[model samples]
Target: MGTVWPDVRLSDSGDEAPTSPQRSHLIGGHDSKSYLAICSESAVNWLKARVSSADEQSVTDIVTRLSRHADYKSTFMCPPKLKQFPEPDMQMAWKYCQEYFDNRVETLFGAIDRRQFEARLRAHLQDGDNSDSDPSWYALRNTIYATGTRLLLTRTGCDAKTIHESAMQYFLNALSVHTQVLFARQVDLTGVQALTIMSFFAENLLGSSIESMLCSNAIRVAQGLRLNYEPVSNERLSPSDRFVGNRIWWALYCYDKHISLRDGRQSCIDDDDISCALPERQASENPNKFEIFMQMIKSAQIQSLIYKKLFSAAGRRQNTIQERAAVEQLDQALSEWRDSLPLHLRPGAPIKKSSLPAGVHIDPVVYMHYTYYGTVIAMYNKFPWTARGSSLDNAAFGREKAVSAARSVVLATRYIDTDMNTTGCLLFSYPMTALIVLFVHILQNPLAPSAHSDVVLMDMATGHFAQLEFATSMQLEVQFVRDMAHIARRAVEQIRRDAWIDVTPFEAPEPAIFSPTMTGPNLNFMDFLTDDVYAV
Candidate 1:
């Protein structure tokens, strides 16, 4: 494939373009490798010049020219034609489907124009029984209906296993429909919405690779259409079009930041390239979706920076002191954001707990708190104190703070609306990072306050990962989150064995997930009178 942007290495794993040979508009009639070289030289020099001072005119020109390249036009520039899906009227708009999303999913992601969507569906139905259908709208329709049905099933207490099976079927069926539509036509705005919905479902189902791939495609398509630019500021669009365009852009932006954090990779979309502002809320808006989503994007962006600078292979310079300072600043920033949230949205602010005994119906605040604490643990864990010999070097308050934050995260999970909302579950590494820090603490200081309690929490957290695995989303085949889960389990098992505790091993014997650690006695025992209490 020809280079889409010769100046930039867009992703760590350049999973953007197909690999097969094909003629491109930019390099038409030229040999593939030779044209690639020629284009690379030209684009790189242009980009280098623009980097020094890239105004709106220059950036727009660059994106415009690149969007026309036949090689990646589908991925980044051109919109695909849409197809109609013929669902029974009953399935088209089930009772309270939109209400469920407005109450739950909408609060998390404000990427869709719910009112406009319903209006379109109603108009399509009213057009006439004899009128030909528009297949383009079908993908979005099915995705929307599928999401609403899943949430509805959970809230209504369809059997626990039944809910899982039924919701999975709805999502899978929609996925099939969406895939076929895109394969048959170019990707359109409705297709982007459907893919975003699928990405949400992938994370909720604990699917690792699929979630990332879906978001990558969604963002790629959004950029192709230049949704990253301010629609209202541009004269080509009306006020309503501007509103819809900004909402989609911000939603895609948030999703990309999330996928980057999950994979510990640099973000696929550069912050410098985005010109759209965060979506604004009207005074009468009830749910505050705009505010929450805006803050969530900011939080995810901070976390993504943490992942890239401290964890990614390309960023392997482990300056503990420097990274510690960065983490501390982020911790403070998160706390400030939480404090600014409205009373109902803030953690521990009495969000529907007294109203419902069942955990399925919840205010989105519960998950927000859980995620924030988990992020805190991820930051605190980066200190050298987590390694074996750092016990004596570790400060009491820092470790105490970490333990408290870990427990807060553990307790918050109980109220996490498992059946309806799985926002935090999408990023399995967040919880895994918390549990590993606790594991490190226990291994380093076994007799500390409630030592086994930490181990118990880690064990419980590992069980939350049962559903996360390699469920395919199109052709993506990586098990990124599942790998983290396997590593966490083995780490917990090792903790038990090293402490001379009973270990019920994994059913199947296999190679260790982590390379063997070179171990030797590093701590001097307190030679005591009783001896048995300290024995290991």
Candidate 2:
């Protein structure tokens, strides 16, 4: 059986009379202890202890419940064959394809070549039902349709429910051919791209674990094709084909690092194994076009290093001094990455609405900041606190960094348009983490000047989730966050009330000591006399 910490016992009556200020005979004045200072310290400590304990149990319960509902196996196994699915609406499909290329495609590290993909799509549509058609191509087309439909949810006249069903139908159509694409003897490049796209679609509907598995499978296939290495100039591949291959490989690399860090799992792609060069902008393209994508890839590299040098099991075994050094090194690297970005793309840089290109979506810009701030929070959120003399000061500095990052995440939400496509989990997870941090801050310092405003920001985040629920089938997760926000609000109110009350200081009763008898076969009575036994 697990042992529980003994509770701090209170007075038998459960209420004690407040003590009057003690007089000092030597100074002929009241004691040096300030009533308000003691009260504040006592309240903060009491709340911190209770909040820490409750957070642990709450997190465990929440994780267990979520795990039970997660569908890990379905993503790996072949999807059930559908007896009947809607015939392709060729015009609508083309429309979605165009929408994807025009707006969404720029945001991702490249996968499909626009001109080549369109020509093939035209031929595929013309060929209609030909036995020679590639199953992988069919899956890729459907995945694009699904992505496009979901992205245009707000622009359509149909009700959100209807639009959502249509999107899922396209996704299901793509998933139905999962086996053909995944189990092919000679893995096609299109198959790898399809799997990559499907994994992202799954992440919005399913969860990170399912997405991780699909991404791992995609990486495996890409590796099988040697996409991890740059193509030789002598190869028969065209310049465009080579560039597309490079883009796809880096896309997989960026995503592998992202999902691994997000899920606390090992990355599928190893930095040591990668020799692929970063994709460059074509001569015909605008010089600044791929800047954001390149920056994201760089950021992902930092994230990979962060997991390797800090969060990995081996890294966790490092001494406090070594850990601090690792953190500082990573922090410097991250700072350099941000600084290397263009002035307009920096984390807190202000964007002029008029300066954005025609039809350009701000989502990518918002995502850059989210990723940057999220990385900052991840670095410091779980930093260790030791018993050394400077530990308290170091902890305070770390906490400040984390809190500042959290605030930045919450503040960035204002830039997110209500009608914007936020079906991705990162869109929700970053703000959710920020909200929880603010919630805890209010609990720890209920009378803080920003406490009331923090509650407002939390409400904004909750409302953001409510909006996103209409775009994606994440009602359960959103509702869970809502319930948590409700509980946090109530806790703030109670803490604030208690803070103002003039109550007696809490004094814990003496703990009852326990002496255990040793009778086990391996027990040695002499062991008790060792210095280690009395160290406690």
Candidate 3:
């Protein structure tokens, strides 16, 4: 008899059947080649002999079982219905919409047209809860409410639990209409926008693989509408409409590339298939307004190149010399892109908070800096594992760049003024990656001048994660980081004590211990320590 797989349905109503009866096969095994995976390997190797048996087991659980794939099955279940509540007053509704536009618009690359959306929102409000209203618009409106409410939670001064519950209510309200919009006979751009917004919300709040699935759907819908192609002169769209279309398409493009990179999956939209033009600045618009959005598009393009040239299966097959050349070329491209940014917006440049326009939040600016440094880290993160023999020089260069970039990321978090609970999971990933690098760096050379200071930075990052745990459901991931920090602290203290006498320098675990051939999918805790499964 064939192996039996559990029944998987997409809805509670049992209206959707499983796409395949067999369980989904693991593509690259449970572990991915993402920075987080690299971090896990480093932690396990460093903590192998330093911690108690129970602590070692804890590390093993986090590495082998706490991955996103382990919980991805939950995504197929229908979202539970939120308890009904009175809708916010029209004044509050409009305020929430404004908050989303003022704060989130640039981060999402102007996913919605402000004037057009506001006009539609006014008309929707006039309809006064009519069920006849377009479901796509209804979903989009609620998602805007969800995003805005979460953003304002810190300022509200209400109980954090109350505010979080309210935000989740709005998110569920938007999801209530998702099926209608998804299965509509004639899917429109409005539906695509709704899906995209909801996907963003899901990523930040829900913390699941569902966000990627929703984004893939949005990409498909946009492609079906031919949004990937530049409009011909004969298509007869107004300049404003063309501009909105361009923004939406490029925004989806950026989201697709970033999500793919984050999840270590193939991108849904291929660059070769896209001919959409980048959004152009209108004559009346400030050049500075376009600066962040344009740079983000460029950043996304670079991310796409990085994955294809360095991380992809074909890229991985390249010999040491070829890979080194590719890394150098990509590094130069990234630097040139950074050099092209405005002075204040450039990574590590100090910005006066007062100079920001009224109503504009500092989150987007901070995120841009984080992204730049994170990209740099991502480019060189694999060097310690992959470097050997003739590649040691390249490894040294890569290590220097990666360490500096990681330090910059950890230091840059000081500028985040927003409540950590309200920020997305993506924000935490960068610092965690940096923390891992710092952890390994300390283990390698505990007596380095910066090692003690780096430990302080690691503590700060752990505190940041503690704050984040209040709102996020990703307890396993947060705990993993905290546990690693504990091990690192203990290890460093031991090294400090040994440094007082005639003691040998601490040496990093040999890279051969992490070879994939020595490990497989069914390893026990001790086995895992002996042969790290997360190695590239």
Candidate 4:
């Protein structure tokens, strides 16, 4: 039998209670050790109030009640309730949130007037008593900044620059808090609250060249966890682990989403889209536009290398292709046998293919653009000179630089691949061939001089590399890819069944060859490969 890892026993074991101040924050002051549960309840109640409110008055009442509670005022909280609010009224909700915060007293709720709510919120946030209880508090402290950002997008209708400038400091603050939460040994309530904060941080900041910063932090945290045998405390580990893992997944997802939204070769926003400017852009594109582009490319290259490493590592841990195919065949045969049973003896008839779960609904244009960006970036940056770069060497000479780079790429690919295989276990098509096509095309016919400049090359290289990293990183995550594909296919089929675009479920398309009419912005990565005639 496989040995289950033993739960870490606390070396400094004690039933000792927290000090008086700490005890005050708990449900009852009976020598309590942690205020996490109360704080969570407070945050949930607070967020629920904010979301359930029909108008600002209701929110104000809720905030007042929250302020009176020790859990709300002294302890930290993160309200996931905000995620459920409808998009249409989110702006108004944000506005109501902000209207109370012209001063430092209250951002959420204080005994003070609406005019002083901001001051009180800031004051409470900055107060020594309520400060630093948990990372979620840090996120809460930054909500005003996010709220301000919402205003910049929806209310003020300002430029990306203005909104970005306004939100940077807060974004950094949240990130700093997130870093602490990720590595904290004694996971607590505040840590779970901080997860949303980290999620937003990854969402906005890790899109451009600075994505390396996010990935580096993630790897470091994971490594730290592996090395440090820490004892789990409270309910923090359960939720925090999920949050941190989910954040990592969403970080990669955001990279994919951003690439799709932005043009293939440029990181700058179109001066119009609300999402074009967030605090992350300011930090990412800091220094200058050229520097930003360079950093972006470098980061993309690093990401691709990591993805490759992870893919290779994962491949080793997972079942072989033959094994997977056999399993699939068995599943298919069993399914057929089940379908063949007599009507009375058969289990409740399975739903037709038409009734599968909803597929992810994504915009065709966005999906296509992102795929193109990733493909192009990978070819140019990840494997700058050649696709068959090596990962082994022992010399210190300049002649070894090429070998070193190759080795580094291989190393990164191995690490990332392991995670995909052991953890993600989802499969998706690789973007390698797509990248190869772009490189070949670029070599055969340089882009028009007018259209192609140093800037374009830099942008294209990074974008392609980003795509390559994502594709390669996820290639071994068989289960996730299958689920995603199944969802997408099912959703498409469902839509087709609607009177709008009537159709039947499609057969799996032929591999290595693509139908011309099926081509669009979001073609699967496999479709970009040249026919067998062009094989290397």
Candidate 5:
């Protein structure tokens, strides 16, 4: 592309134009690359001359000229070069910058409007055509996504509101087209476009229109889909698709009103206007509610929508209210037990035992669910649990399922201890059932480690606890057994120790050794534990 220069004539127009016209443009407005270079050069010049006050207006005029070029206006803002420009009075620079940007946006829109860009693009979409199946479709859409976002952010001097509104309209339209393409089973189109759209939104407009655009079903569809272009007879899919899909879907719920691990307001893309989405933290209180909300979304019930549905569906096959009430009783009991622990003593408390910690700690609830149930639920939701003639075998899977659950309990324990905190028994103090539910909730979390400690399992189920055990030990079972011995000796040696409480035997059961038989689908561990053999 050649640079565009303004043609000028002398008052002696009657005379032959000077051998060459005095072209008064910053750099010849030419190809996109050149335009970018010129704009960048002018921006630098404008920045350098500031200290000396050498022709500030002239330098500004050059910048204005660069901004006036069509290609430069579109592509120059987001590249690292523009962002790195020496800090200028951005607000003040707008006086000249505004004229340059206003002209650029007006020109681009004028061309688009005149050419009816949307109308032309819409022609490509045919009913049942499966356009999303074409990778090129997303390639094109991504280009628009990047270009449109750049226009919103870099277009100087434009009303922030107007730019924001226009950007949102384009985003919404893209989302609509994306959904149509996905439902039409153009997997290729939906996959690429959706991912590009998501990546751009996450990277560029994360706080504002991008996130809100995603909050709707658009995010869910984008995350749920696994697009494949490679030919495979046996339904092979790329890891990237599954990974992106799960992340996008998980992110939607991750930020849902219920999840509380992080302040939603804080999670709001800082640049975007998420004031309406994020609740304000009060001055006087800890902003732990958001963390609590994060935990709920990561919970098994929400994470494993399919299993939850199956659990609900299985309810219709049950025999009596007494049987149903038994399960309900356990959940209610667990909830009550959790409520009784002090906040500091609760799961996810700091290992340091200080009034202040350097960084915020993970919410026990979010960490537990996301580690355990979230991983499995996310996987099972996308992949079929049963395929033709492998014949769904819940019976055989039940024991493995129990192992999986136990592993999750162990894993959540490890995660809570290793990653979230190195020196806290906070999660270990939870009731066995709450621990079990929390374990179930996190059984599927991909981020959770497969490895877990046998000792932590023992402590969570036992009542023997001491400050030393609490502060000193990393493994719950080791601490439990240790505490039990000390308690027994103290009570035996001194009646004063007995005044506090009687010593009890340690009854921490080994992992998955005595899983309750599933009465259809729900395992009744309470009944199994209350049985004569387990008691002995």
Candidate 6:
């Protein structure tokens, strides 16, 4: 078992409590010590009231029961509670948390009012003198700290085992916080935001089924707050506030679709009932970030349609012409969307073709295009590729379109050095999908022009994923990426074997020989990792 560090354990970590007041703002406080110093008299009163008022007795009762458990052992560590810190460490951790939380906009959580959130945190922090007391507020504070610190560390390339394990301790404690009081009422939007951030982390970490459940909880909370419906102007919310609400709603929508599409399940929020508009662009948010977010939501919307129109019962009907027509419509729409992107947001021509170091900046726009391109590749996979067919034959169209789209994806991955791609597991499908398409088509035409180059490209893509598996914290995603690479490699060998067998007419035929349809293992890795609606 991996080492599990306590939340406030003594350690050799470089970051300790900061003493100088001048150096305070840079460290994320509260996130570390919950609140280092409650500057406001109101905050102090609030903490005092909470500490002296209620929940104290109940905490005592729970601790007593745990210690008296029939099978209790001193060797086992107990679940952590809110630990008080001296003025120094709490101040430091709180500062670090604030800094990290600000970065959450780009790294972990999406589309939050940072100024408002910072205010709420300051409002929550109070002047208190209880080192022995545990409060639910304190628990949530550490939760934020753990989440924020982990996001910061992961993004900054601090893959130290000790750091992650310590962060995990706080995270588990936060999740395991006494829910009896916390969830007694409708969870606030901030609470919902926390759940979403946790869910996102869980997905990156490959936390088995918890990622799905946490995301479900987030959707439920958001709906409870009626965030799914747009708030009218008469409600007195400023236009900016309303826009933030809409952004949060879309964020939930996107996350819901992402999780559901991955596992081939239905999304909780039906698009039919979502009347809220997209967030109005604002000066505060980075335009690039907003563009990427909008693009993902659109992609999620497309994914929903893809599931319903192509992979569901409606799509399974034996109506080829209509299906082709429907697919053609979607294909056209996707192309239009791609063409509509602003020039800078659109994928730029590659800068260089060499392996890039981890710190080298890679354009995120490439991944944006990669997402849509992967979708296009998957669209072609719905119908088997055939060189010979009738005028309206989907098989023939699928073959040519898939081959061309696959080539584009391959070229994109080939030129970009993925070692510098900071997203890690998020874009696992991009290169892997490119590799899959090339693998399938190469099997069919190994002697074709550019086939050898395609093999080298697949190797590069596979190696990129392989390096990511061990280097990144997203163990599960990297595992899946490597799994797809194995699948691609095997596919190549199988194609070669089938070539020999095709010459020996008595030998059995390869399933992938006619593998355009999603039968057998010729699955498109693009959709295979998350959405298997088309799985046979």
TM of each candidate vs. truth: 0.61, 0.75, 0.79, 0.31, 0.24, 0.63
Give a tens-digit lDDT track for model 2, residues 226-312: 878768631544666677878888888887887666545678998998887888887755445577678879999999998898767
Better of 3 and 6 by lDDT: 3
TM-score ranking, best first: 3, 2, 6, 1, 4, 5
Q: Which residue pairs come into collision in candidate 1?
A: 76-224, 80-186, 80-187, 82-136, 83-135, 83-136, 84-134, 84-135
By TM-score, the best candidate is 3
* Maximum-lDDT candidate: 3
Clashes of 5: 31
Residue runs of model 5 more than 4 Å from their true location after superposition: 1-167, 183-185, 189-298, 301-536
In candidate 6, stretches whose alpha carbon ends up further than 4 angstroms from where it belongs are 1-89, 105-110, 123-125, 128-144, 151-157, 177-183, 207-209, 233-241, 351-364, 382-394, 403-427, 440-450, 472-536
Clashes of each: 8, 0, 0, 45, 31, 15
lDDT of 1 by residue, 1-536 (tens): 11111111212243444222222224332221111221233433432332323232332232233223323323431225433334536434644346445655543455666677777767765763522233335556655565666667666766444545545545544555655545545546666676776676555543223566677777776676577886744465467666666777777777676555543445678787878877787564544555567667777777666666555664445455655566567667767766776664564333344442322224345546655665555445433312334332254545555555665554344444333344534234345445545544544444343555565666555554333221111121222223323333444455566767654333222111111210111111222222232111
Query: Where is model 4 more than 4 Å wrong at Cα?
Result: 1-130, 133-136, 140-144, 147-155, 175-185, 189-208, 215-384, 387-440, 446-536
User: Comparing 2 and 4 by lDDT, which wins?
Assistant: 2
lDDT of 5 at 80: 37
Model 3 RMSD to the real structure? 10.7
Badly placed stretches (over 4 Å) of model 2 are 1-84, 105-108, 130-133, 206-209, 233-239, 350-352, 357-360, 383-394, 418-420, 444-450, 470-477, 501-536
* Clash pairs (backbone) in predicted model 3: none
Q: What is the lDDT of residue 24 in candidate 4?
A: 32
lDDT of each: 0.48, 0.59, 0.62, 0.29, 0.30, 0.48
Candidate 5 TM-score, true structure as reference: 0.24
Q: What is the lDDT of candidate 3?
A: 0.62
